[model samples]
Target: MSVFTEAEIEYLRSQLLARLATVGVDGRPGVKPVGFLVDFATDEFVIGGYVGSGMAASKKFRDVEANPDVALVVDDVANIDPWTPRGIEIRGRAEAHTTGGAEIGERLGSAFAFDAAWIRVSPRRIVSWGIEGSSFEFSARDVASLPTSKGV
Candidate 1:
């Protein structure tokens, strides 16, 4: 089953960056702009950064380690004159992994190093608006039940 409609999937695929939010052990919140890929097969969002470098030592990774709960927002204004705003908000649990020689690195393209670390987020809830007059929310179960498709 597909978690998103074809149009929604197309919108996601067309966009390159999203804002990822995580909470730290000290109860502080952090948000960063990250390049992401939507894995239609797993219905998850994937992001990678160089490991054993400044990225690995960054606070965002630390925050994810301390609190797996997170949120990601991908949005843009379609127009300025009439004011059409559209985007999707994803609330989910994130799992961090070392991407050494992992296929995920390749999927992320040449921008990411081969040994980069990555985070895969499994969404629990998704809310979307402003695409084709569509506005709705879906739970994980609801998403899982939708028919699956071949591409992102």
Candidate 2:
């Protein structure tokens, strides 16, 4: 009962960059397009949430704690042309960082294109995947959502 097929999930995991949109304490939805790595060739996303100074990066983390349910979307920008690659949407839970998960920061530090740290997100369910012509979708409750992971 998932929106994305096996191939779609595989494609998501293969991609290197995705937008992590988090709600700040102020209830504002903060969106940042960043790089990520899918470990074990699965849905285990270990990332770095480091970027910009005092931009309130921790705001996202606080949001995650306040609301564990999160949306992790990694999609290619749509171009006017028809032949460009399509985009993907993944819905999942974000694990807040801690002293133990600091290692994930280092792991994603080099894998990502950015010089700052990264935050890990585990997709419990995929919401959608498609190009300009078509699209597919899924949800966390759809298939029991993604299991709690260690990446965060």
By lDDT, the best candidate is: 1
lDDT of 2 by residue, 17-111 (tens): 87778776677788766666665444566655443432225666667766666777777644545534466665677766544334554554444
What lDDT would candidate 1 get against the real structure?
A: 0.73
lDDT (CA) per prediction: 0.73, 0.57
The ten-residue window of minimal lDDT in model 2 covers 132-141
Instruction: Give TM-scores for every candidate, taking all chains together and pairing residue i with residue i.
Output: 0.81, 0.64
Runs of candidate 2 exceeding 4 Å displacement: 1-6, 40-42, 49-57, 77-80, 83-85, 105-118, 131-141, 150-152
Off-target runs (Cα >4 Å) in candidate 1 are 50-53, 108-115, 134-152
Query: What's the CA RMSD of model 2 in angstroms?
Result: 4.8
Tens digit of lDDT per residue, candidate 1, span 1-152? 66777877999988988999999999988899987888777788887765455555667777887899899999998888677778888888887665442476676453656345667787777877885573333323324432322232
Which number leads on TM-score?
Answer: 1
Clashes of each: 6, 14
User: Which residue pairs show collisions in model 1?
Assistant: 1-146, 1-147, 1-148, 2-146, 2-147, 2-148
